[model samples]
Target: MQQIYLDNASTTFPKPQAVADAVYQYITHAGTNISRGTCATTTEDLVFATREQLCRFFGGEDSKNVVFTKNITESLNIIIKGLLHSGDHVLVTAMEHNAVMRPLQQIGTELTTDNAPTDAITFSRIPCDADGALRLDALPQLVRPNTKAIIMTHASNVCGTLQPLAAIGSFCQKHNLKFIVDSAQSAGVVPINMQEMHIDALAFTGHKGLLAPQGIGGFVLLESMIDEITPLIVGGTGSLSHTEHPPRFMPDKFEAGTLNLPGIAGLHASLSWLQQQGIDKIRTHELTLTQQFLDGLQQSEAQNLLRIVGKRNCRERIGVVSISTDITDIAELAFILADRYAIATRVGLHCAPNAHKTLETYPTGTLRFSFGWHNTAEEVNIALQALKEVLAHGL
Candidate 1:
């Protein structure tokens, strides 16, 4: 059977040919590390070029402001831990992943220090509407005097609901609150202008919309945030060699040890490819596939057996679509889809239990089908047929 992969929200698969080639070339030919050695010209050149490419891709002014990490979870951890101190309250949306929630939970319990605020840290969740869209109007009422920032996801990984970043960013700017966005689901698939959107920080993963391999993700922050935010890890940065402490620089201050050269190389190639293809074009293609899938679902005989999560409109979302069924065993359905039809999907809370709670899908989660640049309308029809058959078979 032909395999149909629809888990782009988890991680994109079948990355661009150039991405795989770049990784292969880097591993086979260049075996040196960046920032640690002076003689590795190829590695150094690639590193610099990758940074420049990322800066341009994300609309960041300074290349130094882009710091690499293991993944978006690590990036979010670094930001949440480093930026929030005692007495600093943060406002996050109900759609935040475990990446954001867990770190904030751990930090809120800690005591204050001299350099930090005297009071303990606090977090408030801005609620979402019935359609999983963020309620921006509720933001003003939730803001506290101690609120230091508003951290949120640009798009829901579970439901594909696009948050109003510009509106939220404007609100943050008006209130003097820092705006940190988790672009794990939106980056490379959506247009993000840091300066125009008033975004202070953005966390993104490489394996998703960026089309790079896993284990590479990072964030782009305004240069001004460097001094205020603390570093998550401290070690050799290959800069200020004489000093015991990590160098107080843009990326070196945050990045430590050997970087992911292979992943970066892959990312560099994917960025180049994405740049050539254009993000808007990629988005349009994915949205087209999404609509095809939605239309198939609506046209299917199993329509009564399934419930599509979020809004019916594709313009308000990316390519992600979550579905619930009258059948209680959603995982079993996913298994059948996989084992019988070779349709791979993600079924569960999707690492955002809070988001499930907001959607009232807690305890029992929804089945998610996320589209990508490579998915075609025919594949979506096949998936719909599979779902119809599964429903006909019954649990």
Candidate 2:
């Protein structure tokens, strides 16, 4: 049986050919540890070139500001833990994933008491609407004198609702608060111009929207903010070998030990492909597919049994859709669809309990079908038919 995978939000499947080729090529030929070897001149060039490519992809302000981490979670931890101190207030959104929430929770715990290790970091959550969009109007009210930064997820992983980043960026600029964006779900899939958006930092993952392999995502800091934040992991950063102290530079300041050259090489290739294809085209294709899926969901009788989460209009959302049904257990229904129809989807809280709570799908989560550039209309139709069948059988 053919499988229809709709779990791109979790991680993209069938990554671009360039990504696969780059990974294989790097492993086969340029298999050398970056910044460590003296004779591997070509490998060193490849590493630097990959970094430059990432910088270009992110709008090319400074290649040195981009630091490769294992993934967005690590990138976020670096910024959140490195930049935030006790008594420093952070503004975040209700739509953030656990990657952002867990760190902030730890920070909040630390700020409350001296014994709490992280007592210095305080935070306020900007509530999102039922559609999972952030309330931009509330931002001004939440900005306090102690507000050091505002961290926001560019798009909701659970619902794919896009945030008003430009407006938020302007607010942060006017307030002199640092603006950090978690682009795990939005980068590569959407257009993100840091300069235009006035973003101070952006954390992104390579595997999902970038169509690169996992274990190769990172954060890019603004040139001005690099010196202000300390490195999360301190060690050999390929520079300042004379001293034990970490290098007081951008990427070196944040990046410690050997970099993920293989993954970066793959990411470089994937980004190159995206550049060639153009992100706008990819976004349009995915949006079209999402529209097709929404239309199918609306026309089907299954719509009555299933409540689609997030914005009802496709214009306000990305390529992800979450649906919950009162007729059946969402997890069980998801399993049935996968087992019986060979349709793979993510079911449960999707690592964002707050988002689920906001949508009132907590405790029992929703069925999420996340689209990708490769997802076809026929596969979406199959998913709709499978959903109808599952409801017919179980509900």
Candidate 3:
């Protein structure tokens, strides 16, 4: 039986040929640690060049502002921990993944000079509508005099609901609050202009939309915010050789230890491919597939039994669709779809319990089918047919 993989939101599979070739080529020929050598024409230069490529890909104001991390989770942690102090207030949406929630939970109320809690670090969550789109009108009321930042995800991984980022960014700029975007789901799939969007920082993963291998993700900070935040890790930045103190600048200030050269090389190639193909074209193709999936789901006999999550309109979303059945176990249904129909999907809370709770799909969760550039209309039809069969057989 032919197999179909629809889990791009979790991590894209069958990465682009350029991504594989670049990783293999780097490992075979230029396998060397970066920033430890003084030679002008060394592996370090190649690695740094890859970083430059990433910086350019994201429309970064300065290439030095790009700091490589293990993944978006690590990058989010770096920014959340480095920027938030004891009394600073943070505003986040109800749809954030644990990557943002867990860190904020650990920091508690305040930053203090004596390492004692001074004031509680207050946080308010902007609620989302039933369709999973953030209620931006409520945001202004949530902003306090002490509001330091507003952090939110660009799109919901579970439901593919795109947020109104430009409007929110404008609000942040008008309020003088930092706007940090978690672009794990949108970085490579959507077009982002940091300057025009008024984004202070952006966290992104490489494996998903960038078509790179796993283990390489990063964050881009605005040049103006570099001095305001400190490095989360303090050791071996290679810039401060004389002292144990971390460098007080971009990239080196945040990036410590050896970088992920292999992953970066792959990402560099993936980015090159995206630049060549044009992100607008890729987005249009993915949206077309999404529309096909949505239309199929709507017209199917299983529509009455299945509840689609998030907004029904494709224009306000990306290439993901999540559905929950009224009377069937989502996990069991997913397993059957995989075992019998050769259709792979993710069935769970998708690491955002709060989001599921907001959507009222918690505990039972939902079966998520995320699309990619390579998925075909026939595969989407197959998926819908399989779902109808599963509901008929199981429910």
Candidate 4:
């Protein structure tokens, strides 16, 4: 059986040839560090060019404001731990991943003198409708004087519902609240202009939509937020060895330790490819596959074979779709899809219990199918047929 991969939300598979080549090229030849006064193959100029590429792609004001981390989770941590404090309150969407929720939970418990925030952080979950769309109008009731920032995901990894960043950014602007976005689910596929979105900070992972390998991701923040967010990791930045403290400046301020040169190199290539392909072009192709699957699932739903958990349509959403059925256990269904049909999928709470709760899929989770750039419409049809077969005939 031909293997069908439908878990791009976890990590995009069959990455662009350029991505792998870039990583291999770096590992094979250009083994060098960024701040330790770079070597030939990997220069400070080359890495800075990657940052510049990201800045241009994301519409960040200054390339220096961009900071690299191991992944988006770390980027969110640096922002959450750096910006929020004991008495500070934040607003987050109900569909946020543990990357955002867990850090907020872990904060305020530890009292730090100068490194990180010690005060316990409080937050209210902005409710999402049963379809996983954000109820942005409820923002007024959730904001407080202590509400320092609004941190949220750009797209739902579980259901693919997109929250309105422009509207949320407007709300933040009107209230003077900082806007921070987790773009792990929507980075390369979605067009994000920080200045236009009024986003103070945006975190992104390169492995997912950006088509880069794992262990490489970061964020870009406005210069104004520099003073507000403290550096989470402070050590050798290779820039300022004179003092024990971290370099108090952009990039180095938030970026400590040796940078992921290989990941950065891969990201550099991926960014170039993405722009060459055009963001709108990628979204159009992925959403086309999404619609094909959604339409097939809708037909299956009409026959009572399965139920789509989120919006049946692909508007204002990415390529992720979740389905539920009373026919068999969802996890078991996923296993059967894998074992019998070679269809890969993810099934469970998906690391966002609150999102499950919001979508009324808590306790029992849905089997998730996510489309990607490499997925063909024929593959979507095959997966749909496989779902129908499993639902109709047990084992």
Query: Over the full model, what C-alpha lDDT does candidate 2 score relative to the true structure?
Result: 0.85
State the TM-score for model 2.
0.95
Q: Residue 57 of model 3: what lDDT?
A: 71
Model 4 TM-score (2 dp): 0.95
Q: Report the C-alpha lDDT of model 4 over 1-395, residue by residue, as the tens digit.
A: 88999999999998899989988988887777766753644557678999999898888999999988999999999999888877788888889999999998887432233544324577778888999899977889888777888999999988999999999999899999999999999999989999999999999998999999899999998889889999988888887688887788888898778888889989999998898899899999999999888988888899887889999887899999999888789999999999998999999999998899998889898899998889998899889898989898876
Query: Quick one: how many clashes does candidate 2 have?
Result: 6
Q: What number of clashing residue pairs does each candidate have, in the order they appear?
A: 0, 6, 4, 3
Candidate 3 global CA lDDT score: 0.85
lDDT of 2 by residue, 286-327 (tens): 988898888777765344867888876677678999988888
Q: Candidate 1 — which pairs collide?
A: none
Residue 284 lDDT in model 1? 97
Which residue pairs clash in candidate 2? 86-120, 87-120, 110-118, 110-119, 111-118, 111-119
User: Cα deviation in Å at residue 308, candidate 2?
Assistant: 0.7
lDDT of 1 by residue, 1-395 (tens): 88999998999988999999999999999978876776688998998898888887878879989999989999999999998877788888888888888898887842223334448887778989877899877888888788999999999998999998989889989999999999999999999988889999989899999999999999998887888789989998887998897888778888888889899999999999999999999999999999888877776424477888787769779999998887548999999999999999999999999888888888798999999999988899889888987886774
What TM-scores do the predictions have? 0.96, 0.95, 0.95, 0.95
Off by over 4 Å in 3: 38-42, 109-118, 301-303
lDDT of 3 by residue, 96-164 (tens): 998988888888543323554347776778999887899987988888778899999999998999998
